[model samples]
Target: MISRHRKVLREARVVGSERRGTWVYYWVLPPALERLPALLQVPEPAASTSW
Candidate 1:
């Protein structure tokens, strides 16, 4: 599943998967953390004109 998204993941600076035993873990390098806030940002609501 993840292999299909390699290009996007690489651009996002994700370090790919690590397999230990039966488990797989995905890691993001420090630079990716800086992008998290922008990805999760919420726009402010518009003000109501009616009183």
Candidate 2:
């Protein structure tokens, strides 16, 4: 899991991380932050009239 996260961060180039003591913290870079909403959006599901 950690490897996968690292790979994505490296590939995206839109995340910044810092280590404080034993903990590492990450945040979206400014340019990426501006586009984050659109990146995270998903299409609405089709309406279901019958359950």
Candidate 3:
């Protein structure tokens, strides 16, 4: 499933990766992070105790 997402992102030019030996490393383009909303999305209110 992850590989499928990676392929999509790669085709969209949203990310890049490199394969080394038996491992593959993936990365989101640096500028993309800045364009994204905060990683936590809507902040939890103080009284919200559970996810």
Candidate 4:
């Protein structure tokens, strides 16, 4: 799972990470930060639902 996440971040070039001992830390890059709000938004649910 960690490898998968790392691969995505590396491919997107949207994050940076550093390893300290047994743990890894990650942070969003400046370019991605600007888009984070849009990326994190969830669309509204449908106006109608059928049971």
Compute each candidate's TM-score over C-alphas: 0.53, 0.50, 0.56, 0.56
Clashing pairs in 1: none
Worst 10 residues of 1 by lDDT: 10-19
Model 1: how far residue 4 lies from native, Å: 1.4
Task: Work out how many backbone clashes candidate 4 has.
Answer: 0
Q: For each candidate, C-alpha RMSD in Å?
A: 3.7, 4.2, 6.5, 4.0
TM-score of 4: 0.56
Question: What lDDT tens digits, residue by residue, belong to model 2 across residues 1-51?
Answer: 996887698579788888899997887789888988999999999988986
lDDT of 3 by residue, 1-51 (tens): 988988998897679889999998889988767767775488776885766
Winner by lDDT? 4
Residues 1-51, candidate 4, lDDT per residue (tens digit)?
Answer: 989988799789899888899998888889988998999999998799779
lDDT-sorted candidate list, best first? 4, 2, 3, 1
Tens-place lDDT digits, model 1, residues 1-51? 766686588666765666899987787777778878998999999988986
Which runs of model 2 end up more than 4 angstroms from their true locations? Answer: 37-51
- Candidate 1 accuracy as lDDT: 0.76
